[model samples]
Each structure stands twice: as C-alpha cells, then as structure tokens.
Target: MRYASITERLASLGSEKWAVHVEARRRKGQGEPIIELTIGEPDLPPHQSLLEEATRAMHAGRYRYSNGRGEPPVVEALVRKYARRRPDVTSANVLCFPGTQTALFAVMLGLVEKGDAVLVGDPLYATYEGVIRATGAEQVTVPLRPEHGFHMQADDLERSITPQSRVLLLNTPHNPTGAVLTADEIAAIGEVCRRHDLWIVCDEVYEELVFSGSFASPFDDPELAERTIVCSSISKSHAAPGFRSGWAIGPAEFASRLLAVSETMLFGVQPFIADMTAYALDNPIDTSARMRQSYKSRADQVIAGLADAPGLTPVAPEAGMFIVVDVSATGMDGEAFAWALLDEEQVAVMPGSAFGSGGDDFIRISLTVPDEMIDEACRRVSALAMRSGVRKELRA
Candidate 1:
C-alpha cells in the first residue's frame, strides 16, 4: 500500500480542538448535557438578505462556473468595499477565493518562494505556521507580550526581521487572544514593513465583528499600500461559514497572481456563494451594533464569572469575541486542564497551547455560547480550579 509523501504534511496541522470537540459530541450523543465552546462558531442565523440573494441567483440560473476567475459582480463588490475606506484599490486589485483560509495560503505561496521567511505574531492562529511550513518558507515569530495587552508591537517586528524575511502577517481582532491592533499600531507596523521591504498580509476576517471600537487596516496606509495584501471573508459578518465566500485585495500585479493561483487551486468559489457574498458586502448591514451588544453582554458575563474562579484570570478583550484566561496558577498545562474539565464537568474549551507555546499557560473561551451555557461552563471551570486546593479560599 503506497501512500503519498505529501500526506505527512497533514500531521503537522491537525486541530487538537476538534479531537476534544468530537468527544464532547459523542458524550452528548450518550445523553450528557455538554457545552462545547471549543470552536469559534457563532450561534446566529445568517443574514436574510444573504439567503435571499443566493436563492435569487441560484434560481435565476446564475449557477454556472464563474468567469474562471471571479463572478464580475463579486469582484466589483469587493472593490467597492475597499473603496469605502481604501479608495486606492480598484477592482483589478481584488482576487476572489473559496475561503479566507485558502487565501491565506495562496498569498504566501503566490508571493514568497521557499527558503524565504514569513514573520508572524507568537500565539497566532494555529494554522499559520503550518501554512508557512507547507509553503517551504521559514516561519519566524515576534513575541506578543501579555504586558502589552497581547498586542503586536512595531518595535518587535523591527528587531525580528532578518535578511531572509519576505512577508509580515498581521491579524487584527486577533484569534485566541481577541486583541485588536489600533490604527497607530498598523501605521507603525507598516513603517517597519516598508523599511524592511516586506510584503504585509493582514487577516481582517473579524474586522466587522469588533465589539468595542472601529477597525483599521494597513492596506489603507499609503506608505505600505503597494506592498500590502488584505484578505477577508463574508463568513463572519454574514454568519454563513458554509457559503465559502472569501477574497484577497492587494496591488494589481499581486492580485492578478493571487487570482491565477486561486483559480489553479480551487477554480473560484461557487457562483451562487459569491453572488450572495457580494450582496452582503455591497449592501452592508449594521451588524457591528448587533455584535457589540450581544458579544459585550456575553463577554461581561464570562469575565464576571471568572473573577471568582480559583486560579484563572480572564483577560478582558478590546474587540474580538474571545476571552483568553491565564491558567498558570492551576498547576496544569492548558491541554490537561481542557480535557479534565470536559471529562469531569461536560464543558469543552480549547487548550491554549494549540495556538502556540506562548499560550501554554492559558485557555481561550469563545463567547458564541448562550449566557446560561457560559454560566454553567464557567461554574465548571471554577470548580476545576478549586480542585487544586483553593476551594476554601475562593469560597470565603
């Protein structure tokens, strides 16, 4: 039995959260009332307009293979999106993809050749290093210090770049940590990228879901405008992950290459999905108000609940919808704690180490669950902490 050598690459990139989540699902099948907060799935309905537009397109027989690059409407919609804030980019700068996850890889693969380095933030989204490795590029990480509210600093990037570094990957409204980089930070970072001659890739997937304040991007920075590539998805804003609607916007030359790669890789997204996504982006919704209201309420509940927890401290997020709790005092690594909590209390959360070793002493909790569910999960988390012998102290 001969297997492909490329299959070895898969081992470098499996999500540990899914293994724990599957077990939680199995327990639920056996009648356990488990609360699974391991994945960043928003428990909300997709927008009515998105649904209607997709249905309209499908029924109107607009379901054929796309123009082999992008449905014109979808590409143009992405253009108008950037135009609202980044008038520098025209329709030629947009490249549509099946999903933002693929766009992440496509940009790296399309731009940086093997042996070049892709610099990223420590404790980043789990797949980042894997994607870099698969592209045969070295993944260099700049530390995002807890002292700095887990935000990526420009000085850090300035010091980390070596001669081989070719790309700088930035995630605003970051995953796992939930930290949003400010406009000043973006500009400063872009200055560093410009000085060092690095291609900047900003993953703004959660751009529209910022809970506390407005979002900004370096793509809007004129200094780095030519060197920056911004990739995002309709999945988060529309609450329609299954639609597989995503795109990349960069310089005209790079965007053309990115589209060529995207077409060679996935041959463009389904026309109906792209049409729905275009409609969602063109006729934007004030979903930020809705997200801010719901997520803040839920985040406040989690933060308040963890205040009484024995050995955990929930870091208050500035924007994105996750609470990363420092659990070093628990005398257990995040993976051990997450499994124990799931087995003993039927509550599922992601082990922070899966994000990176920087998160080994922490755990990430999503605010996607209902208020009551988070209450129960936090109660279980507090109980787990108490087992480390702080029960009497915490109760008192």
Candidate 2:
C-alpha cells in the first residue's frame, strides 16, 4: 500500500531547528564565535541540593516507571507549591508531566478538535502555533500592540472570538516580548471568557520572574479558575531545565481527560527526575531574587542602548528576559536584519517574523547571555547604525 501524505497541519509546522542549523554553518565557515542570544535558556546551574538528590536516586536504582500522573511525593509537592500561590485550587486539579510543553500538547489534544478555532496572541511563543496545528485546530491571532505596552486588550480578544473558538492560549511574562498582564486585564479577559464559555490555557513558566508587580493568574478569579488550565515548569524560574518536571492545574474533569492523553504520549515521566524536582520545589533555592535583579539590569541596559541607536524602538520589558526591538526604520525586514547581524557581528537574535505578522519589523533579543556579551552585542548594533548613517540623527 502507498504511504499516506503528511497531514496538512503537520505540513504547516516549521522547524526552528533549521534556523539553528543555518547559523551554525555560517559561524563555522566564518571562523566566528557566535554570541547566542536567541533561545530563552538560563545559563545558571541547578540547585546543589537537587544535584545531590538526583545522585542518590541514580545510585538507588529509582529509575523505574512511575504512575502516569506522577510520583506521589512530586505530585504532592507541586500541589503544595500551587496551593501556596492559588489557595482556591485543590490538589485534585494538579497533574504532573515531563514538561510544560508536554502538558500543553496534552491539553490541546484533549480539548481541541479538528477544524476548531483557538485564539492566540500575535508574537506568542513560536512552539505554541505548532502545538495548535498538531491538533488540527485553526489559530486566530489577536495582535498585541506595542503602543499599549504589548498587553492584551479584552475588547480585541472578545472581537476575535467566534462560535468555533474553543480555547484561548495565553503566555504572560510572555516569550519574545516579555509583557506581563495586569490583574485587571486578566480579570477582563476572564469576564469575556465567562460570557463566551471559552477555555483558557495559560502558560506561567516565567511567573516567578516578575519584577515590577505581583504575579497574577487567570485562576485568581474563582469563576475563571474553573475554566483555566495552568501549565508551568521549573525550567525558567528554578533554572532546572534538565529536570523536565512540570504540572497542569485545571478542573478535575479536564485534568482527567488530559491525563488519559498524557498516558499514551509518554506513559510517565522519569521517577528519578520527578523526585529530584520535588526536592528542589520543597526546598527552593534563594535564586529568584538574584536572577530577577540580574535580568532587571540587563533589561535596563538593553532599553538604554536601543534608545541610543537610531531607528530602533525597544519595548521596555517589565518581566521576563526578552525585549522586542522594532527595526522598520532601517528599511529592512526583521529576517534580513537578523541574518545580517548574525553574519556581520556574530550576534544571534531571533527574527521577529518567526513569531507572526505583528512581528514583521521586530527582532527578539534574549538576555540569557552574560552581561558583557549583551554589552558587546549592543555596541555592535550601534556600530551598524553608524555605518548606515542613522547615528547622525541620534547625535543630533
């Protein structure tokens, strides 16, 4: 029998790996040291206690299959952590998974049907679109305007919702733009969802990284909590990316449905990592304060540097480690500018176009690299401005 063609949704999904490969080849050929500022990966080490616990678990042969939901201790630890933040939510609402991405995928599989519509913010995390497409769902993008500080507008959100809209995917302390939604804005969106009978899938991976204001959840409202699915991981906040431990919190019915899908996806997460992750969660390191301050400094520097460079408008990020800079005045698209910077200056930044239409003239810069590297990248960007005769305007 002839093999069936790839599904349309799968065909539409583009691999970010291709961009990485291209950069690698270019760097090798040029004999240049690439200062990678593309991916949002923390360069910090994991908690020492977590490392010790993982070592013990490895020696004790604790690598066996666990309950598909998660090991009891890890699940309990996650429940306690979540309860501390969201007292209204119960342990029954939490389900552990290998990572937040896995939980998101499971949630989409369980909730969205073929040809269904899902609302997503423009300049959203690129991986989200792939996950939505994998479910054979249509993605309706809601533009987040830079003029409004890149925050989501409830009116715009409501206007985008349709009868086919089943879920709204949101990332606050959002990726690529680092815009955090205020509690009032979240409440407004909740009200819209309440009226429209929509489900919300919120990615709060960077919740602990907020600098200016208290972290707010869509689940902060009882009515919205009933319809919200929170997917969070220890990767960003705790600097434990390798642990691959995350949890999903939502209505028990939805959790059960997602659990069923999760079982078939990966059977269960590794018990050793889960146990170590629980240890880290219960005994959190005092890194949040340090990490937040460092990122705050970087964010300020990036904003100031971009201001000095002509034709670059940088959005000041209140939280998270990314800033989106508009480069439209340079007479080049985001993709072209990104490639030129990577090739000429050996700086690697993601093209804003990779995010979607609203990102055409923008480039996303991650502060995951060292402070010195960021300074150098800014200097190179300034040099480019000077070469292009844009510096004259800034000097004036």
Candidate 3:
C-alpha cells in the first residue's frame, strides 16, 4: 500500500532528534535516578479561577458543536485581547484553534505550498521545521547568531528572501534560546517582509514569559498589519497546556480565508474548552508573573553553578522558560554532551542540534523543574563539563 508524500516528509523529522530525552525518560521510568530538564512543560498548575471556570462551563453544558470559525465568546474575548494592542481588531480578525501548533499548521497550509519557501530563523523551535515541511513548502533558515543574542538580524532575513519566498515564520521570546525581539527589531523585520511581499507568521506563545522587557510583534504595527499573523495560546501564559486553547490574529480577510482550513482540520475546538479559554482571556489573570520570576531565578542559578566549570558557558535569556548553555569548549557537540551527561550523571537536557545547526554547540535546559532539581541538574552538568575538559587536557 502507498501513503501520502507527507509521510515521507515527516518520517525523518520525528522523535529521532529526541533520542537523548527519550532514553533519559525510559531510564527514569524504570526507577533510575534522573533529573530531566528536556521539555518545556510548566512546573505549575493552571490558576484556580481558570479551573473553576472550566468546571462551571462543564456543569452548564457547553459540550455542543461549535461553528467553523470558533465559539462566539472565545472569539469575542480574543478580539478584545488583541484590540488593546490594535484598536481595529474585531471578531473577523481572529480565529481560535486547539493550540499554537495547529494554528501555525493551518496558517502555513493556507499561505504556502510545494513551490513556495518559508523563511525562518535557524536555531528555531524543534517543531517549526516539521510544521513548515508538512505544508510541502521548503524551509529556508536564516541564522540567529549568538553574538547578537540569537535575535534574527533583518539583513540576514532580507538576504534569504527569494522570489519563491511566501512567508516569514518568526518566534519571539523564542523557544530554546529565549531571545525576545525589541519593538525596533520587529519593525526592521516587518519592513523586510513588506518589501518582499511576504506573510509574517509569528508564534508569540512566550509573549507572557518575558522577564525584563515588554513584548513586541509585527501585529502591533499598522503598516505590517495586513501581512502579519500571530499565533499564540494560554499554554505558557496560563500554565494550561492541556486545554489546547489558542488563536490566530491577522487581517480580517486572512481570518476569513483560514476559517475553512481550520474547519476542515478540527471543525473548531471543544465548546467547553472554548468557554474556559474565554474566561481566561477576559478575566485577565496574572498567571505568568510567578513563572517569570521562577524561571529567571532558576536560569540565574544555572549560570552561577556553571560559572567556574571549564568548557561550559550559560547564555542569559531575556525571557522564557529555558536557558541555552554553550558546551562546545568540551570538545563535543551538544548531542554527544547530552547523551554523555545522561549516561554518566543521570541528568537529561535537550541537545542544540535538536533545534538546528546554529545550536550544535549548545544544550537547552528547561527551567520548569523545582529549584532543588534544577540546582542538582546544574551541579551534574558542571561536573560533566569539568570531566570533559580534564579529558581534553589528558589527550593533549
């Protein structure tokens, strides 16, 4: 029997990149001691109020089928949320989906196809390539150099845009690197998109997790409004990943066009979940503050722990829940270091290569663990780095 070409495209893009994480999990599952800092699951639970709202909606029987676009209340809440940023935002400019991942997939499908190209930053989120590839479009990567704090430079972006380029996929408070783009930086990138006649599809899932600076996006600029589309969710913001509540904000016409694509995929999220999501957006809770503080503190702890460790250097993140540590000085790339650390010290972390070649020399450590766990993981990581350095000296 034959399958769709998508199977081939996605086969090589699957969990193989996560071999270290998977093995660490398997070991921990078997009762082996392992400090896992691989994935970005929030260490906390959803706010009590959000939980209560979901229960209330359930009791009120919100389980009926929803419209192709989204549940009314959720759409309205989204409109109000974006309206604060863009006074012109309305229901027609918003469409809700299960999560940022689904919204991104739909947006990509609607914008690009086999002959088109999607320009994204290298060292991107792990799933970004898979999503772009699933659309049958080519993924063109522009380097996000660490020398510039991993933010994508506009000149690099302009150079990568070819005649076939149709979209620029961006993530702010970016995953893996946790680099946030300033407003001026966004304007520069948005200008490049405008000149190249490209759609700007930004993933702002970490918008609420910025520690030091305010968040900015192309969606906030009127000049780029027509071409800018942002996908975000409450997963990180509200610590409610299981809810699968997210939305895409764009020009009204784009929303109008993407609604059919969304409908075909899932027909809209569960109404009960939509109700819970509406409550979340409208109530305006400050669920991210604690996360911001905790993640920042943990990141600082990791940096401090590795300060004296030879062959290890932790990059300070501007925002988000993970910190990137450059371990190339140890004479091993990220994948090798990650596997060795897990085997020798029982500490699990994601290799930089899992993200992209730009991160090959680094390891991404999630700060979503308890303080003590992260501290312990930091200790083990430092020890590994020291050992690798000593081994290098002996070889010399």
Model 2 misplaced stretches (Cα beyond 4 Å): 1-7, 17-22, 25-31, 389-396
| Candidate that scores best on TM-score | 3
- Root-mean-square deviation of Cα positions for candidate 2 versus the true structure, in angstroms: 2.7
Candidate 3 residue-wise lDDT at 86: 92
Q: Model 3, 1-396: lDDT tens per residue?
A: 999999999997889878888998899999999999999999899999988888888889988788878899999999889999999998889888999989998999999999999999999899999999998999999999999999999999999888899999999989999999999999999988988899999999999899996999999999999999999999999999989999999998998998889899988788888988999888868789999999999999999888998999899999999999999999989999999999999999999999999999999999999999987898899899889988999998
Clashing pairs in 3: none
For 271-345, candidate 2 gives per-residue lDDT tens digits of 888888888789848766667888888988888877778677888888887888888777667787788787777
Better of 1 and 2 by TM-score: 1
By summed lDDT, which 10 consecutive residues of candidate 1 come out lowest?
A: 387-396
Model 1 local distance difference test score: 0.83
> How well does each candidate superpose onto the true structure, as a TM-score?
0.95, 0.94, 0.99
Clashes per candidate, residues 3 or more apart or on different chains: 0, 0, 0
lDDT of 3: 0.92
Name the runs in model 3 displaced over 4 angstroms: none
Error of 3 at 211 (Å): 0.5
